[model samples]
Structure formats: structure tokens, C-alpha cells
Target: MRRFLSLLVFLGLALAQGLSEVWKAVEVPGGICADGSPYRFYVSPGDPRRVVLDFQGGGACWDAATCSPESPTYRRRVEVQELLLAQGIYDRLSAANPFQGWTHIFVPYCTGDLHVGRATVDYGGFRVHHQGARNALAALEYLFRNHANPERVFVTGCSAGAYGAVFWADRVLATYRNAQVALCGDAGVGVRTEDFPGFRVWNPRLPELPGLSPDPEVYQVYLALSRAYPQGRFAQYTTLLDGTQVFFYGLMRGERLPSEATARAWAESALRAVTAPAQAENYTFYLAPGSQHCILPRPELYTLRVGEVAFLDWLRALAEGKTPPRVRP
Candidate 1:
């Protein structure tokens, strides 16, 4: 009986692939962009038992100068077509894609709150709505409503969205209850400065995660989630010297442009941030050597490799409920 059910699922997925899936926009009430515009997320139909919830990362801002769209700090809006344009894991045509026939929920980031803020701030006259948590929650609820009992759920994001992936993985686990939920944070190794604005500015309603500080670090989410969900897999992927991460760290330090010295400092901090999480049995990391930021949304997901392990293979293992060995520089 079980073999017959499995064969039926395989045939269903094959038919889904044969149909050439396209993204469909889902708009929920209370979902709004940072610019106070109507916000909607995109979903692509695929195998009903497998789902991928991806958060789109542009950038983030904390103060008035950075918050201004003119400053080029973060994305203040989202477009429906961006999801269809992304090539890597989202590329349904590629045979190398592990998630080719999985249901995809593309979560666009515009709240500048790392997808976990709840406060609104008026920087002088320009009001910025930091309701990332609200927007993300609405999207998650939509996933819960549509996919009641998935076999697997891949929670992931790049850059700012990577942080979102970690922040929301616990909730995904809670919703699925019986599903194999895995988290992969692409290029969002949370390495921020001491002076970086904590939770006070954005005022996120944090989950009841033990070991998470009042002003939490990115690794805290990793550690907390690993302990909280031992059966679930949690992982991170980042370049050894991520230029964008260094650039953002420089911004927190009041530098308009980061010096080479700042890059070195960022590397050290990033390495230290991964230390504790790396020790977790289920938490793994892939630290490739380069300055490039994100890979999951790019072609590098298939071609890039470290040592003997291809990134695509490692990611496939993670999505399939296997704890792939970590690859580090």
C-alpha cells in the first residue's frame, strides 16, 4: 500500500513538471510593503507534499538616512515578476534542480526589518512602516492554509532574506507538525557590530525561543532552533569574505565604504559566529572562499563546489532529510 502511494506521488510530481508551472500572486489582508503599497507574495504550483518558502533579500536600513529609498540601502517595494526571473533553485526547467517539482512560495522583502519587525518609525517627516513580521506571518498563514501536511518544507532566503529564513523556520515546523522541515540560510551569516541597532528600533515580536537574547544575534536563532527542533535540519551557506556583509558591517560602524581592514574584521566575526552553531549535531555550514554574497538564487547553486562536495548535491541532501557534512574554507 505504501509503495503504491509513493508511486502515485511520483507520478503526480511528474505531471506537475510536465505542465510547466508558473508563479501565481497571493495577496492577503494586512500585508503591506514598507512604502505603504499593496503587498502580495507569489506561489508556484508543484507537488502538494513538498514546498519551498523562500524570502527575497534586497537590503536593510535602521535610520533616516539609510531608510530613504534615495540612499539605496534596502528595497522598499516588491514586483511580481522577480520570482519568475530567479534562475537557480527556482528554475523548474533545470534537471539539476532538487526542488524542481516542489510548491514554491516566494516571500518578497521590503520592510527593512529582516522580516521580523513590528514597529513603525517616522524619520522626521517620512514615515517608514516596519511591519515585516506582519507581512511574513500573513504569507506563512497562506502556506499553512494551502499545504496542510507536506512531506518536506525548505525554509530559505538570501542576504536579508537569509536572516528571515532562520527567524521563521521554527514557525514552519510548528505549522507542518509532521513534515520534515529544513532551513538553509544563504549568505546571511548574521555578523553585526556591537553598536548595531538591536530590537529597540524595529520592535519585533520575537518567538518564544530560549537562549535568544533581548537583542539577539543571528547565530542565536540557529542555536535556539537546533535545540528546539532536533529532528529538523538547519544550515547556512556563505562565502569566506562576503563583501556585502562586510559593507553592511561597515555601515553599522559609520563607514560609507568598508576598508580592507573592515573586511578582515568581518571575516573573523563571521567565523566566530558559526563556531557554536557548527557544534550542533544537526546544524551545518558551507563557507566557500570568495566575496560573493548569495548563491541559492544564482547559477552557482549547481556549479560551485568545495572539496569533493558539489553545492547542489549538499543542498539536495539537506532537503531530502539527510544531514550533509559541512564544507568550510
Candidate 2:
């Protein structure tokens, strides 16, 4: 059964990859996707570390014709059942790609282009895919079976992806070694769990938390992953909020919903995320003087000129053996 499945899967993958040169639309499995089809990310394989599977989101309820099982989106999400791939933040041990000594996988959860106010209630963009991080992690796991024994593996996002970066990285890091991860948490997600484990968050020690995002597993994942490696420290940071909190993504300003208490909740999560790490090497946060969402997209908004670039540098430092500052968030 395994061998046949493997052959079938391999053939399917080959067919999908080949389609890039020839076909466009294809059929899909039943009950697997909303549209009953699959898509692929089109990333090159042979990675030593986990694969970076970015999930593009936008409340785009594309018709069956718009998306299909044989498409890049579906293939990327499903491929890996038979391979040695894993996701959710991992050490970029030089082996993944002989060319790039190190490169982290960022499986952002947001699907469609998330343009804040321009959107409407008809399309609850934020709510449509709040748990994109979870899917990204799952895809990573699916791709890298070798991820089970990581040199290191991790997952993160950009705008709505921050929560995913924090939650998945902390969970996998707490357990995996040589782990360093970051999320450009654009819209600030709120994290709170009533009965399960809390999340491990990292951002600069700004005057306030970004917003409170409720999570059911990030914190728990952190504790579980961290329990295996007790000495690993978390590398994190945040930029200053020059009155852009509400405009960017506070509760009062849902980046999607908008609310003051909501923004406060986000800030609260920021505080908890930094402090969530229990060990000496655990949580760390950096509060840039003034910053807002998508510095990578709009670097001009950062108090520290190189907001997003600096964050990636920190990830590199964490991977290599330097005790990058987790700062006092």
C-alpha cells in the first residue's frame, strides 16, 4: 500500500510539475478542498531544512474553475506526504541548499492580498483566514518528514502572519534545537488561551503590546518544543507605534475590525508573548522607536530605517550561534 501510494504520489507530483510547462487547469480529489481541488507553491525541492510554504489568503472563494486540485496551490499544500520535509521554523543547517548556506522558510497564511479598509464586511478578510499560520505549519510538516528530526525548522508570515511566526516558531523552538524565527506580524494578532498552553511572542519592548490574539496551541507548542531544548533563547523585537496603532491594526482599528480595547488586547499579547518564555534563554522582545505594518513592503514607516531587514538579520544571528538580543520587551 505504501509503495503504491508513493508511486502514485510521485507520478502525480511529476505530472503537476510538468504541467507548469504545458497545462493550466486540472481536476482534484473529493472532500479535500472547498473547491475540491489542490494547489502547489512551486518551490524547488531537495531542501535539508523545512520547506517554506506561504499560504496566500484573501477570502477569495474562487470557483472550481478558478482553482483546481492539480494547480500549484494544491500541490504545494499536499506534496511532502512522501518526502523529507517539515515546516514551522527550523535551523537552516547548510545542507538544505548547497548554494544558499541558510534561508528560512516563510509559509505566510494570508492568501489573497490583504488591503485593510479598502475591503468590506462582505469579505471578512482578516476573519476569513485568521488561522493561516496553522495551515502553513501543517504544510511544512507535510513536506519535511525529516523535519521530525530537525537541524531546525520554523514557520512565519508577513502582515496577518505575525501570530503564525510567533506561535509556530515558539512551539517548534521550545522543542527543536538551533531554532531562530521571526514574523513581520503586520496586523498584530491577539493570543490568549483559557485552558491550554500560552504562546511565545517576540517583538521589541515597546511601551505597549500590539494587540491580544487568542490562540489555542502556540503557547502549548512552545512549551512542548522548548521542553526538549532548555538552553535555546528566543530572538524577537518590535518597532515604536507613532500613533499608528489604530490605523494599522488595533482592536479599535481592526487593521480589519478596529477598536481601542482590541488594540489594547494586542498590546497585552505582545507583553505576554515576550514574557511567555520561562527559561533564561526563553522570551525576548525589541521595541523599535516607531513602526507600523509591512516594513518590508513600506520601510519608510519604521523608526529604525531598516525595520524588516534588521529583523531578518536577527534570524540569521539566531541560526549561527550568536546570542542575538531577545531584549526587554
Q: Which candidate is the best by TM-score?
A: 1
Instruction: Report the lDDT of model 2 for residue 216.
Output: 36
Residue 8, model 1: lDDT of: 84
lDDT of 1 by residue, 1-329 (tens): 99999998997676555433477777768777789987888788899899999998988889988998587878787753345455788787787899988989899888898999898899987988889998899889888988998999999999999988988888887777689999999988888887788367899866667768777788888989988888899999989899899999899888999988889999998988876687789999888999998998888889998999899999999999889998985
Name the TM-score of candidate 2. 0.47
Give the number of the best model, judged by lDDT: 1
Local lDDT at 137 for model 2: 42
**Which stretches in model 1 have alpha-carbon errors above 4 Å?**
1-21, 80-82
How high is the lDDT of residue 131 in model 2? 25
Error of 2 at 174 (Å): 8.6
Candidate 2 residue lDDT tens string, 245-268: 333333222234446665565566
Per-residue lDDT of 46 in model 2: 36
Q: What is the Cα-based TM-score of model 1?
A: 0.91
> What is the RMSD of candidate 2?
12.9
Candidate 1 clashes: the total is 0
